[model samples]
Target: MRLSLKVWRQSNKEAAGGFEDYKLDNVSPDMSFLEMFDVLNEQLIEEGKEPVAFDHDCREGICGMCSMYINGRPHGPLRGVTTCQLHMRSFKDGDTIVVEPWRAQAFPVIKDLVVDRDAFDRVISAGGFISVNTGNAQDANSLPVPKEAADDAFAAAACIGCGACVAACKNASAMLFVSAKISQLALLPQGQAERSIRAEKMVAQMDAEGFGACTNTGACSAECPKEISLENIARMNREYIGAKFSSSAV
Candidate 1:
């Protein structure tokens, strides 16, 4: 397939950025999106031009590092898939594809299509883990988790921190990502000890990181590669309110 790419180019976070155009020919339909970029890079290198820079690792989609905005959508037009998992066949021949990095204050561009997502790490660090001593691995049957709760927790835990939620939201909210992390731990028995403070701290950290408030437009979940439910956001709000009330009562 032949294609035209309009990709964002930035030297660093403080550098002014804009789109640069390139044309690619003889692209294979079976090639992963990154592979197509690789081909483009090869051509650029052979022509003595600087190659496009994009983040990618574990191209099978597990890493969530391939965080590109393709044609105005996070990870292209596909559902439940990351940019690394997106295939060239998803596009038509002679199509013009617009690619950009995650456009959020919290995710400032480093260069080209790469953005600094360390803000997510900071949010998780605030209160996304269970500090209690649960000891070594116990028998699965020893603590029988309710089927529904376990399923829901696992679903929430599937979030890959890709920042698509931020990119998808006009407000650049990290609520969906933060909520998923909170929900995953809050739904499990092991996470109960920290539950009260977890929601408050993480939400506070998210705000400190400059992420915007949830728009209530549901764009985050719709573009989420993991399909993390919007319900997690509601759960997080309840947890936060409950935590605040309990703290004030003391």
Candidate 2:
């Protein structure tokens, strides 16, 4: 198949970037999107042109590094899949594709399709974990969580922190991502000790990171590759409100 790619290119953080058009012919439908990019890079190298820069690693789709807004969607037109997992077959021959990096005030453009997602790391660092005592892993039956609770927590944990939610939001809010992180811990007994404090600190950090507030537009969950439920956002809210006037300080 043949396609025209309008890919953004930038030399560095200080460099002004713009879209550069490239034509690719004889593209294999079976090749993953990243594979197609690899071929394009090879062709550019042969012509002494700097290849387009995109973040990708563990092309197996486990890593969230392959972040891009493809053809106006977070990960192309596919649902529940990342860019590296999208195949050329999704598009027809002679198609024109516009590829751009994740857009968000919290995510600074590092290069072409690469954005600095360190804001997510800072959010997690704020209060994503509990202070468990040093010991071997607990036995499965030790906590004995209910089936529904366990399932909900696992579902929330499915979040890969891909920033798809951010890119999909008009406000570029990290609410979905932060909600998933909060809900996963809140549903477990092991997390009870720090639940309120976790919500308070994480929410505070999210604001400090410059991410806009969520407007309940529902775009985040719709574009989420993991399909993280919006219920988690509600759960985080419940936790946050409870923390506001706690009997004692966190």
lDDT of 2 by residue, 49-151 (tens): 9988899888877778899899999989998999999999999999999999999899999989999999999999999998889889889788889999999
Question: TM-score for each prediction?
Answer: 0.96, 0.97
Tell me the spans in candidate 2 whose CA falls farther than 4 Å from its real position. Answer: none
TM value for model 1: 0.96
| Cα lDDT of model 1 by residue, 1-250, tens digit | 9999999998887899999999998999999999999999999999998888899988987787889999999999999999988999999999999999999999989999999999999999999998745678767688768999999999999999999999999999999999999999999888988898889899999999999998699999999999999999999999999998895434
**How far off is residue 226 in model 2, in Å?**
0.7
Worst 10 residues of 2 by lDDT: 241-250
Q: Which runs in model 1 stand beyond 4 Å of their true positions? A: 132-135, 248-250
- The candidate scoring highest on TM-score is 2
